[model samples]
Target chain A: MPKNILSVENLNGGYEVFVGRRRVFVHAVDDVTFSLHNNEVLGVAGESGCGKSTLAKMIYGAIIPPLLVKGGSISITTKGGEVLNINKLSIDEVRRKIWWIEISYIPQNSMNVLNPLKRIKDQFIDVFRYHGIKMDKTETVEHLRDTLTTLGLPPEVINAYPHQLSGGMRQRVVIALSLVFNPRIILADEPTTAVDVVTQRTILSLLKEWRENNKSSLVLISHDMSVHAYMDDRIAIMYAGNVVELGSSLDIFKEPLHPYTRALIESLIRKGDKSIRKGLAGQPPDLINPPPGCRFHPRCPYVMNICRSEEPVTTFLDNDRYVRCWLYTSSR
Target chain B: MENENMLKIESVTKLYGYGILGLKKFKALDSVSMNVNLERPKIAVLAGETGSGKTTLLRIIMGIVKPEIGRVLYRGYDIHKLKGSTARWYRKEVQPIFQDPYEAFNPLRRVDSYFYDTVTNICGIKDKDEIMYRIDESLRFVGLSLDRVSGKYPHEFSGGELQRISIARALLTTPRILLADEPVSMLDATLRVGILNILKDLKEKLNMIIIYVTHDLSTAYYVGDDISVMYRGTLVEHGPISKVYQEPRHPYTSALLNSVLEPDPSLRDKYPAVKPSSLELKEFLIAGCRYANRCPYAKEICWTTLPPYIDVDGVNVRCWKHLDYKL
Candidate 1:
């Protein structure tokens, strides 16, 4: 069995936005638990409002204003066999030790995060400098060049501004920025979403190579099911701030247990497919006032009485397959 | 040929900085020519990558941008040179649904007001009863209603709902050709199918020709009757959607179809690794074939001059590789 890299327990968090004067908590991620293991890509798949992005932000400890970390314990196993709950640590401590060194986050629109005015080389250097680690300038340049070349990008991009490069190039540069430290864990939130199909393939393959070489666990969040199928080793389906299903990639895709998972898989239309595929006949739930009991019950075709009134417990099937559905339960 | 009710884009070429000063120059859209028969309704997908000139072509079709070389003829009339009444008629004949629904609407104004304004202004409907009726009919076509969007602002609705409202607004004019510019790209994958279904319905039920613009081939295959594949501001290949998807004539088209990751995990074929270049800006500025830099079967002629559209099994392919075979 592979060793656990990070374990999240009962994680609950949301954004608190003001509604005319009263503050309301939009439950983005709630009561989610999962363990990410060594050197596996765990895909988080769901619709736009399903809180997968929130889960990524929460896991990164990016607790900015309006986004409140209500409760959760994120425990990480350090290299020296030390178990530390980084969530409880100060922002400064996490920034100094946890970020870039241990974990890296690649956002969807990385161009927004990167300084538009600064050259790409300066951005790469700023991350190293932020950790207060003094390295020789030539060595840092060499390291940056190596990372870029490894990702199939030319090293001359270091001299160009963010706006000068195209969308796909910028996405690769962002991934390169995150890989500077060769972090043991990477959280990539739709890194290839905005790029074209050709570029998407290149970016994802490069990402796979990076993961393989570094032996790192990657958490990829994408709304497209095909992307998850192409990249993920394990899959987790989130709906209305809760993970409705989790399992190995082979088992999950071979036989999707959850009704929502089934619908999502069925909804995809391939290039040569002639049959008519129906979109799910409902909207993604509003997290602010989500449906009670099972969040997916409203849309679930096989909904039961128990599914409406009582929240279904996570049933652990053989081979670590997890499902949250009344139909899967023995009692039902 | 002149009497047929069809859209004739006669060798349209649009270039940036053509008559401008001190601006970096490139062709926004190359010589793109195609015919859309308006006798019957169908969904024609303008499919391509980002910066592939799909949006620029749509903008040119809508008269938002003028072609530097050729003209767009709709129903045997030059669209760009129409007179007052003909232009007003042209306005009523063509309508566009932009990519971003949130940007299409004014956040400060109520959503229904725009519907009313479209019906009143462009549609030229004066009576309040007639305006409401037209708005309700169009809204119902998109699985929405006047009541649902009566008092809602742009921010009050979901992306899907706002997109539906925008579609409803476009339908109020009863456009013969509905231009959708990447309508589903901003939408979630699950919800985008619903919008695609709406486009299909428009073709089937209302008998409207929809020029559906998108980068996703799957959804394009799902909705399109015909597909025009573009690469880097040039139309690379075009044919019936199913045929083009099955056996892509152009190399770029084949590469595009190859790259789409199928949802079934068991069918995860090893995707071909493409080495990306640092400077893709040269693609736009290249005089010959724009995809010549990446195309596998490029010859000497491909670099010096652009190839004419060669007919291959009813598909028009813009590649020098097919020239010898076609001849």
Candidate 2:
């Protein structure tokens, strides 16, 4: 059996936005739980403002002010078989020890990660030196040249500044910087959102190749279902800061259990199909004060009276699929 | 023949980025031509990625950017030559719906003020009651109402709702041609179809032409009647939507079609390797095919000479493979 690399249990986190002197707390990511095994790709799929990014941040241990991890724990089993609770560690400790060596994070707008003034080679060298990895100028240059060429980039790009490259090339450089340490787990949040389709395909393929060759795990978060379909091995559908459905990628796409997932799949305009695709009527609930019962109940087509008053528990179905909906509950 | 053509673009070319010494020039749009018929209103999709010049072409059509060569003629009158009331009239006839709904409206101002201004100024409406009446009528077409958005600011509404209000504002003038540049790309998947449905309904009910520009192939296939594929400032393929999508003649069009990942996991392994070109500026100034650097079937001839447009069936394709064949 494959060993679990990272396991998150009942992770509850939120952002506190202040209105004048009054502080209002928005529960962005509530009770998000999932496990990523060794060498597996887990996709967290959701629309914007669904807290998918918050969940990734919490896992990567980014707990700055205004954003707090209220409850739950995240455990990562390192290669030495030592379990590290990310929440218990300090920000500096996480950055120095765990981050970029065990767990690396690539944010949504990764193109802006590079410093404009610095050359690409200098940035890579700075990261390594900060980690206390001593190397001379020739060694650093040789290492960067080999890595960039291996990642399908020309070595000459190391001498150029960030603005000299296109959006896609800059994104690749960010990816290359993240992979310098060969972290066991990578949390990539919307890595391909801004680039064009051709560039997106190439980046995704490069990521897949890297993961397979290195035997690492990846948690890919994106709002595009087609992207998740192409890259993910296991899929988790998030709605209003909750994981409404979790299953294998193939099964989830072929037969989605949750009403929100089904509606999202049906709404896509596919080729060779002339039938009208209908969008869901209602908007996503506000994370600050989401609906009481099930968050998706207001827009669900199969909503019941009980669904309006009580939240449905997650039920396990065949083929390792789990869904949070009244339609699949045994009590119903 | 003149009456049949609604909009005619004749060999339009746009250049960008003059270097310090005025030597470097990036050709954004090569010699491109197309004609839209006013007799039958249909959605003509201009599909391509960034740097493909789809957005530049849309801007040229809206008269926002001036082309260095050729002219855009609307009903036999050159758009660049129009002045005063005629230019204002042309602006009313062709409206644009931008990609971001949040950026479309002023944050401090009430969203309805834009609607009111569009009705009064662009539509040339006078009298207090008539302006409100026209605004309400257009809002109703987009499944919105004046009451819901009358006093609300832009921040008060969600992205989807804000986009609908933007569309409602666009409908106030009853534009003859709608240039939508990635209108639904920012919205959620569940909300994108609603906006697309509204566009389709407006095309059929109002008999208006929609020039939809997006990098997405699926939405293009769903709503487009005619499709034009652009790559690196060049028009590579043009034909009926289904014909071009199903039987792509140009290599770039085929590559673009193949790049669209369907929401099906069964075909995951069928994805072909796509090599993205790194030298964007160099490719833009290439003498031959811009896509030749990455094309799988590129030959020596593809790198030396620019291929002429050849008519295959009813579609026009720019490729060396189809040059010898005629419909």
Candidate 3:
């Protein structure tokens, strides 16, 4: 078997917030087990509040107060062949040793990620400074310029403030900042959702090119199925914080096993197809008090009686595909 | 000429500027003209990349922004110059459904209050029973009901549900024309289709014309009967959806179509790859064709003079390449 760079075994994460006076726990990421192989793009797709972002945050080991790591651990095999369980490490240790060195996260919105007041140069230097990595001023400038140029951004972007650039350009600067250390795995959460189609294509293509050149693994998270279709080698379909379906992009699109996955693909409005597609009936489950048994059973079209009582375990299928649905697996 | 139940835009132009004395001006919309008054209601998609001024054109059509030149005529009354009753009539006749459904309403207030506000004011209904009936009728058209949304705030519903509510509110007036601006762009794929289907049902059942403005061609193609491809504040191509999708006459239209990543695995890599062009704002300032700088087939004349609209097989294409070309 190929050495998987990042292996997440039964990862569970969620948030704790008070609704009124009572503290309610929001189950966001629940028992999500998937591995990221080297040089592959793994896409996680779900609707808003499905906890795909929370899952990415957990994987990046960015868990904070209120956002508790309820259970499970994330294992990573660094370039130096050191195996580390990220949950065991302290936040400071993870920050200095892992962040931007082993893994980097590109958030959904660059406007929120970037510092509006500082120049792009200062932002890049700040990251290295926080990590206690000293570099010559000219050398750092030259390296930053090289990365910007390679990503099809002008070198002058380093001197410009975040407000000076457009949304797309600012996103690229964030990406450039992320790539400064050449992390082995990059977790991008809805990177292209904020930009226009042309700019989105440019960012995706550039990221793909960069990944190919560096042989890095990418966990591309987006709600847009079209983006996943073009970028992902494999996909994990999340519904109500559970990995309902996992398979190759081709198999996922062509032969989706889970009913939710089927609905997702069916609901897509493709070019040259004029059929009256529709949204799934009912709202996405409330995570604070998700439905018993299968989280999707409330909205599931082919939901059986068993699906309403007992949750189905992951059923491994041919071609490394797996699905958590009563239709695919027998209930215990 | 009395063109009743018709919507016509005649050479509309809008400009925006920021410089010394506001001298450095750029055309937000440049003489863009389109019309839809089909005997049977149909959706006409205004599609383009961002900064293409498709939204600007929609705003003009909605009468939210007045164009510097040209006129928007709805049933022969100039949209911007309607009198008191005529303005209210125009408002009832033409309604706009905005993007960001959450922003469509006041988040702190009950979602149905906006419904009552519209039905009472613009729709001119005051009786609580009559208001509920009108709101319920519109809501049911979008697969929702008044009771479900009556006591609910904006945050209580999902993005899809709120969007449907907004669409229902637009339907409250029973408007002849619906100007939907990126109705489904904010929703997830599963929810987006439902909204599109609702729009489709409206045109067929309610006999209402919808001008669907979207950057996404896939959704546009799904709901659109007529398609007008815009590029940098100008309408480059306008024709039937089938004709335009199959044979895009304008270079920008072709590029826009090619750029759309169709959600089919089999048809992957079937179309030519579209290179992402930088300098997005510069296109609006181009004196000639707005798409000339990025057009692969851009000729010398494409750089100097704006290409006039040339008719080709029932499709109006703005490109010099189609000039004097036979079918």
Candidate 4:
């Protein structure tokens, strides 16, 4: 197996997302631990307000004020076998070494990254120049042409402005820009949320192609489970800032250990299954002062007394699969 | 076309000229008709991607947009024909819940003001106490109380809470039918079900016919009784939710079903990467079928002539291949 390219241990972050004098802060992410293997796609599946985006920001070192990384560390293993601690590094160090070169973050809104005035090819050159890569204009053009062609994007789009391109084309351009530096890991948060189903599929397939060709690990975060099903190798289910279930994509879908995961899986519409998909009753708990024990106990169908009193420990259910639920606490 | 139904959309066709400079016109809705039964009030999901005229259909039903040719009847009254007080009554009968809860209410105004305005103006509740009582009951029905949301701004509450409040405001009017346009698309998945379940409960408890317009088929399959697949403003298929979902006779319907990426890991290989075709305005106004370009089952006749609506096993499917084909 390839070496673990990314390692996140006990990562925690909170944000004062809303306006309040009560000093209300959403404990968006708390004590989350996961690792990304080389060429592996880790799908982070959760509802909105679950801190998946916040966690993505923390990973990419994109934390802007009001959102602070209180504790924990992110360690990334470089190609040279040198491990870099992302959290301990200064903003300058992160910018010079991490962002765009070794790691790239694809935000939910693809338009945000592209300058409306600049041509798509100019943006590509800007990314390359920022990384201090020394390739001539002709070489750069050739590289971009090959990249876009491989990704199924028409090469002629490089001359088009951000607005001239469709939403799907803009999204593809952003992904192509992220790949300009050949980063080791790509952090994509809801990249396919706003696009059409066909566009979403194209973008997903392109991402899959990128992972295979470059041997890069992908940390994809999306609320749509179906999007995760399309590209994810392993799935991590989150609720109220807690990673309740982690397992192979097949295992999580076929045999979900956590109540939240089970409900989420059951809620999705399957082709053959015409039975009414029952949505979970009640809302996700407020992250400000989430329930004392398990944050999901309020909405969990198989809630036990202990689930209310104490948080369950992560159990090693099977190979590489971890679940935090009372039902899986004991063996079968 | 009037069938004791809550809403009757008969051969509704909404056409859009490609502005002054453009040469062609776009057919956003192509003689698409549907009968929504009020007696069995349930969610009738009008599933389609963007530019499918789902929003246009909702606007036409709400009397915001007039169909070039066709009629939208609510309770035996042609919505377009009604004028002044009669149209006002029709508006009160059919209410709308927009997708964005944050934008639905005025940011400067308190969320409760909408509730009061809806109660007093639509329901005609004159007394202050009576309006308060009505608002309180509506709020309670959506699992929200007046105390928690009475004097709050849109930003003060979470997306889920604000959405619930939006539902409460819509409920205060006590409309017979609620047209929700992608109500849960903006919400988080965990919070989405809350809003979806609320709609489900409201359907049973209040017996309200819901014309839910959305692109997400999963939630549509979850709560919808009847399903109607719209493609660039054309109705491809419509029938019982189970039959349409199970058999899916229309090629567009089949493509949509196959495109849905499930969270399930085992079914990874089931989905084939397919992109939505970029449709031009002129393509929509084509002589025959709008989907003929992308449809693999398209025949020579499909390209030039419109396919007649054939009822196969009780499900209405508008496809040349399904004309002789039965499930």
Candidate 5:
């Protein structure tokens, strides 16, 4: 049931952002669709100009120019089935064979990806010699000291230096240099947003132990629904750049069919539930010309009036939940 | 809320350079002290994490940094012993909200001219219909409106409406206290509780007292009633946010309330993880218990001294393993 490793479909991007001479556009990623399965994690969530790091920089190929990709398609697949597209490749074949071999991001500042005068094993051999890979520097420092002692890290943090580590050891050396090339899908935008709750639960249990030891597929953005309830297994959501909901992380934390994911899972922080959480009243809708028909219909609290003029659709909802809202189009 | 003694701050200490002619120092607030009860309207949360002096104790309670040896005292008046219109009336009764409402105002100015320059320099309002009726009553007490933020421009608002117009320009100087350093930590967990319900409705409709420097222990236990926490520059735990977050008794507040990440994916692998040490600025200039090297219950006299604040029942808690749960 696993293999869907990164899909996407009707995604669209935006941001020509001029403002003075007036070239606006903003749509930061509307009509978004979601996928990613293989060792599945998904998450995303929303708020804060709801682009979710412009849909994790258009699913990690890290798009450029005032951010382009005006329409759909992403694909990825790989594990040798090799579907690929990734917004029609080439930024040196998406940084030589899909950035870190089939997707590997992790951004959200670990001092903007290490290199403060190198030496966390030379930034893991400058990303394993920019993928050409060759080895024998004492077997690549004993496989980066056995992958930083299988992620519990401290192999003397590979001779320190990126400002001698801390901000959770340079986010565990940028998740052990985005696992040199064991990639398949990692994304992770707000990668435990500026570390601390125990280094955001040890960098989300080292990306759920490197996606259960390389089965891969993670994604995970964050606006913290308890860091997507401790690292997703399917969650999506977004707003003002669409994707009102998607499901399973035990059905969006036990049935949240979008009223902004039930006020963002009732504004979380539940540990022995004392209640009164509330929050979501407004603000998270300006993707410029946004509010025109369900860009979370003017801060949807079950708005109605055909959710301020149509555009609802998505609804699947059974085991693999989907929900787009007008109360899941009147429960289909 | 200033029936005198609005801020006391004694023994502050802010060190920067020293040692090798520059005699090296970086204490960033060590001899810390507190007191703000101007007839109780409090909200003191300088909770830590980011070199934990909590934005250098909110830039030393907003006189914008200066604490070599303490005493801030705003109403019992000592902000480094004011001069010239009493330090501009102690900077208009101490008001600051900065934690980036997109760089807290002046994106080519006009988020209502800092609400008509705090209604003409802290409510002296030289009429323009009483500075547009006190900037439409402090932007309708921060649910915002002055023609939905009139003449807007901190990039036309929305970082939760430019932090509710920077907390309605620090509540147009009816400011008894509102330091708010981490003001909704770069907002957006659903517009961070609409700026934490407009600072818990301006501390219950303007009795006003809010220090709220945060790291977000669930919106500081849903809009704090008092919490101190701060570490690496001391005040390891304060009181009453329902007894320092439900009886914490500091093992760094029970490892920061068991490293709060519960959105419940079946409590994903139960949380213990918290490495953070990579040591060396002489281990945060240790003089015993700077969280005793990630304390699990470190007792070699908790690394040599400084424990004592043990109240326990009324909950002050500094921790020598709760000094035998002292009664």
Candidate 6:
């Protein structure tokens, strides 16, 4: 079996939104458990507000105000064979040790993450300096130029401002910044959602090349299934803060076990297939007041009496696949 | 000459940033022309990436922006020259569905007010019962009803539902042409197909022409009857959807088609190589082919002069390579 790099168990997190004078707790991610293996790509896909991004933030140890992790623990095994619980670490410790060196995060919008006032080269220098790397200006510039050229970016972009480059080019520069530290794992949230098709293709290819070359793990979060189909080795389908199905990408696409997964795949508009595809009926449950029992039962087509009263336990299937549905349970 | 087509755009050119004193101008739409026949309603897709002038073309058609070189004709009447009542009639015939549903309406006000306003002002319905009837009927066409969103604000509806409401409001005018600018790009994947289906149904049932502007090729292939591929600020290829998707002649068109990531794992390794443009702004100012900088099949002549439109297999291709090929 492949060695697990990160293990999350019974993770529960939510946002506290204020409704007039009262405070309402929205359980965005609930009881989610998954393990990320070394040197593999794991894709997390679902509709918006399904808690995929919240789960990513929790895993990356980004627990800000109004967004709190209520339960469960996340443990990461470093290359030095030391196990560290992320939630137990202090904010200073996470910033100093865990962030940008052990694990990195790429946000949905590249412009938001990059400092508009700084040049591209200065940004790289700041990251290196923050990590206490002792390098002269010449050495840093040489290193950055080499890295940018290797990633197929022009060397002259180092001198340009953020607004000077196009949206796609700026996104590529953000990707380059994330990989400069050579972190063990990368958590990217919708990296290619805003770019064009051609730019998306290039970015996906560059990510694949980076992963293979460095032998690093990736936790890619996207709502587009086609992106997952192209980049992921293992796929996790999330619905209402729960992992509905987990399996190999090939098996999940060919014979999806969960009804939600099947509906999502069927709704995709493919090339050369002109048959009218229908979207799922109803909207995702409100996180503040989710329905009882299974969260997906209301929207699921294969709802049963048991599905409405009790949540189905995770069932292990053949070929290392897993599903959470009453239809797959032997007791049904 | 009197044009019999429903909409005719001739030599429309729009330039931005006239240098310091109108010196350094950037060409947004270069001498573009197209015709939309209303004999039978069809969906014409303006497909391109960002900054490809697709949105500008839609804006030009809607009369929101005026072109410096050419004019848009509606039923043989120049849209820019139309007077008070004539312009009002033109606005009733051509309505737009914006890209972001969240910004399409005022959040403080009720969503149904837009529906009622459209019926009263654009459709000229006076009676309250008639306005309500028209609003409800138009909502039904897009698989939504007035009751579902009767007194709700824009925040009450999800992105998909809000977009559906926007479409319903557009239908309130009973437009002959619907100008949709990336209507489904903001929607989720599951919701996109449903919205596209509603647009297709509207074209057939209401006998209306739809001009959909988007950067996505999958939805365009699904809903578009005729596809026009745009690069930089020019239409590189325009033809039947089947022919364009099956046998793309322009290098940019072929690249766009090949770049689409199909929802299948078996084809993961089959992606084509895409070379990122180093000088994006320079390419826009190129006098020859704007795509020559990134196109792999570009030649010396392609960088010197613009290519003429060549008819090949019933498709109009603007590439120099097609000049040597026999059609």
Q: Judging by DockQ against the true structure, name the best candidate.
A: 6
How well does each candidate superpose onto the true structure, as a TM-score?
Answer: 0.97, 0.97, 0.96, 0.89, 0.36, 0.97
Worst 10-residue lDDT window, candidate 3 chain B:
B265-274
A-chain TM-score of every model: 0.97, 0.97, 0.97, 0.95, 0.38, 0.98
Candidate 3 structure quality by residue, lDDT tens digits, A106-224: 98786568878898899989988988889989999998889999888878888988877778888888898888899999999999887777788789888988999999999999999
Q: Candidate 6's residue-wise lDDT over A163-220, tens digit each?
A: 8788888888888999988999999999988888888888889889999999999999
TM-score (chain B only), all candidates? 0.94, 0.96, 0.95, 0.94, 0.39, 0.96
Query: What shift in Å separates residue B104 of candidate 1 from its native position after superposition?
Result: 1.8
What fraction of the native interface does candidate 4 get right in terms of contacts?
0.48
DockQ of 4: 0.42
Output the TM-score of candidate 2: 0.97
lDDT of 6 by residue, B1-327 (tens): 447656899989998764447778888888888988877799999999888999998999989889989999888999988888889899999999999999989999999999878887777889999888998998888888888989899988889999999998988887899999999988888888889999999988888999999888998989999999998888899999999999999999988998899999999987767776566668789898899998888888888888888899999999988885222
> In candidate 2, what are the lDDT values of residues A179-223, reduced to their tens digit?
999999999999998888888998999899999999999999999
Worst 10 residues of 2 chain B by lDDT: B318-327
DockQ comparisons of all candidates to the true complex: 0.70, 0.75, 0.67, 0.42, 0.21, 0.79
Docking class of 5: incorrect
lDDT digits (tens) for residues B22-136 of candidate 3 = 8788998999887777466999888887778988888888888999999999888889998899999889888898888988888889998888889889978778899888889
> What overall lDDT goes with each candidate model?
0.86, 0.89, 0.87, 0.82, 0.76, 0.89
Tens-place lDDT per residue, model 2, B154-192, is 988889899889888888887899999999888888899
**Candidate 4: which docking quality band?**
acceptable
